[model samples]
Target: MSTLAYGCMGLGGGWDNNPVTRENINQAHQVVDTALEVGINLFDHADIYTLGKAEKAFGNVLAERPELREKMIIQSKCGIRFADNEGPKRYDFSAQWVSRSVDNILERLQTEYLDIFMLHRPDPLMELDEIADTLSVLKSSGKVRHFGVSNMNQHQISYLQSALDTPIVVNQIEISLAKLDWLEEGIMTGNADGRDINFTAGSLEYCRKKGIQLQSWGSLSQGLFSGRDVSHHPQHIQQTAELVRELAYKYNVASEAIVLAWLMRHPAKIQPVIGSTHLDRIKACAQAPLVTLSREDWYNLYASSRGQEMP
Candidate 1:
């Protein structure tokens, strides 16, 4: 496996509001084509994307190109519920809800089974045994081949693992230069005695140690690096931009490649979920696998983000 998965969040919502655009659909198809061409074997998706519009769009693409399914790994998440123009959203991890959600995902994607299905987020009121039993049934029934979770901390993962027979394969978390608290202590830094350190202790390093793939969302820092200027941001963004520019020139590639390279440089083998809606940007992301940043450069970028040298 390439250890790099392409994210399809843009297909549902995020950029523009044109889900029906022929140009957009064609661009998505082009992304798939490019991904396969460049050896990207994994595709990340969520059921709540654009209120399910994203999966429907991708389903159309898969239906049109049936042969591509056999060549790629398709992963999707569920458990989030949205209200109608009002009220707070909710999460449901009940057995019935999970079963129905998987069925709906299969129907929307026009597929019989998903390679991987994840709980979109940890439900505070969820019963570990119930969730595990549901996943166990889904796996045995062939509705899903694997199970995982998104935005889950170490404690949540440990709790679910203890109740489930299956091993969790991946932990999808928000990881990027802008998000590094997970790499350090769980403390969010700057706050006194904070409970949530932005992530759990040893989460990233633990994933690296345990062979659980750390899939990075917000890989491009929500397109912050794509901007042409960094004057309004902190000095770290500027410094990182300079290093990215330097590496881009050396590699003869886009600055995005440097950003991806920085993530890839980590020992954890981080797989970035590219959120770009542009075909050209997707292609640029593909080039990231080819660009190799030196240890010094990688640490330099890291230091810039940390605002200090590594001890």
Candidate 2:
């Protein structure tokens, strides 16, 4: 699989009841072309993105170009439910819901099997044996090839894995130059200030030790250090942006690439999910793999983003 994935959250128009327009499908086609041109074979989706229109739009593209399916690794997530008449918006991990969600996901994606099927979030009321049985059935029936999770802590992962017949292959979380909690938690371990960090301690290391892939969502940081205006921002952000631009110029890649490179430079081999719908920005992000930051440069960006020297 490619280290970078094209996120389909921006596809199929807005989050309203409006039906998908032909323009939406055309836009999906363009995004697919650009991502494939840049060697991104992994396409990520969620059942709730644009109320399922994102997957529908991509399915339309695949329906037209059936050959494209063979060239891609498609993964979609479930377990997140929007508020409906029966209940408030919440995560559902029940056997009935998981089975139905996988069916819906496959139907929307227009695929016989998903390369990966991930639980989008941890459901507090999830029954380990029940959910594990549901996933096992999906895999046995050839609806989903592998399983993963997002936004789960180490303890949650371990408890769930205890009942699973197969290994969890991926853990997606918020990891980027802008979101430093994953890194900060590690460096702040055993310090009084570490209590303020929100990340789960040992989560990153647990995944690494178990050989689970660490995927990063929100990896671009909303163009914070890339090209967005930051004049009114704090001095640390301004300095980070300046440093990112300098590195981009030196490496002959986009500032977006530099930001992503900083994350990719880690030994964990984090895969960044690029959510940009713009062609230019997508192209800019593809250049990330081409530039490898030096050890000193990596620390430089990390320290600059931290606003102070590391302890």
Candidate 3:
């Protein structure tokens, strides 16, 4: 069984406005069941996800089915604060905020500890020593089993890693066929042409070297490969979708599976986080681990997605 993680961001209805309802709880329960049915053991959540409604709904289902907790690995993130009554939209890495966020995450998930707790984003003003000491305290107290960060570059992760004794287990970032910089960075190096690819500096190779599991968010690229409107999409997106669709037909799997399979094919072992709320789409995504793309096919997809053959 593939260890694809299910993202709960789109759960509990709309974000910033709609509070989690009983209907949302019911939907969450169904989604969780579907995820487990498809061998997805990891559930990803963030404190800001739907204003915590995602975790609330998840907690509701777990409250009813406490047994299911043993069958899953629960992870949640913090450090991102929206501009409501607070100062402005910002990232807070203060020990106090991290502690409080974990408390709320635990309460909403109806759990004693999170398998993994991540900083949602890098706070420019983060105090390394203070954050490290704080995370060490949390780990010792058994509030969080492991630590990580999201949307962080290699240097940011390196700075954090330098302070902590525990390893940063994962780095979740936006990665998809549509977002090709991870691949482009290595390809463009030492070339005279010097393509302008704004990838996080050496983060992909760094993660591979450090054994940090790379978890991909926005993994499906908003379903561009899964029958999203080709007419409205860019020419490259259309070409990428076409190639993905052709591969899907050849591999006898859904187009989403092909898209995700491409990510999984990377040597870094990138885990794609699926956020689809639709049951059928979720099931289709589960087929990703089953499809293995050949070397030729993988490069073809990459070249097609890049809208040009390699130089």
- Arranged by lDDT with the best first, the candidates are 2, 3, 1
Relative to the true structure, candidate 3 reaches a TM of 0.97
Per residue, candidate 3 scores C-alpha lDDT tens digits across 243-311 of: 888899999999999999999999898999999999999999999999889999999999988888897
Candidate 2 clash pair list: none
Number of the top candidate by TM-score?
2
Q: Which ten residues in a row have the lowest lDDT in candidate 1?
A: 186-195
- TM-score against native, each model: 0.90, 0.99, 0.97
lDDT of each: 0.80, 0.94, 0.91
Model 2 has an lDDT value of: 0.94
Q: How close is each model in CA RMSD to the real structure?
A: 3.0, 0.8, 1.3
lDDT of 1 by residue, 166-243 (tens): 788888998887777765463344446445565666677666666778899988886566555789888878777777
Error at 273, model 2, angstroms: 0.3
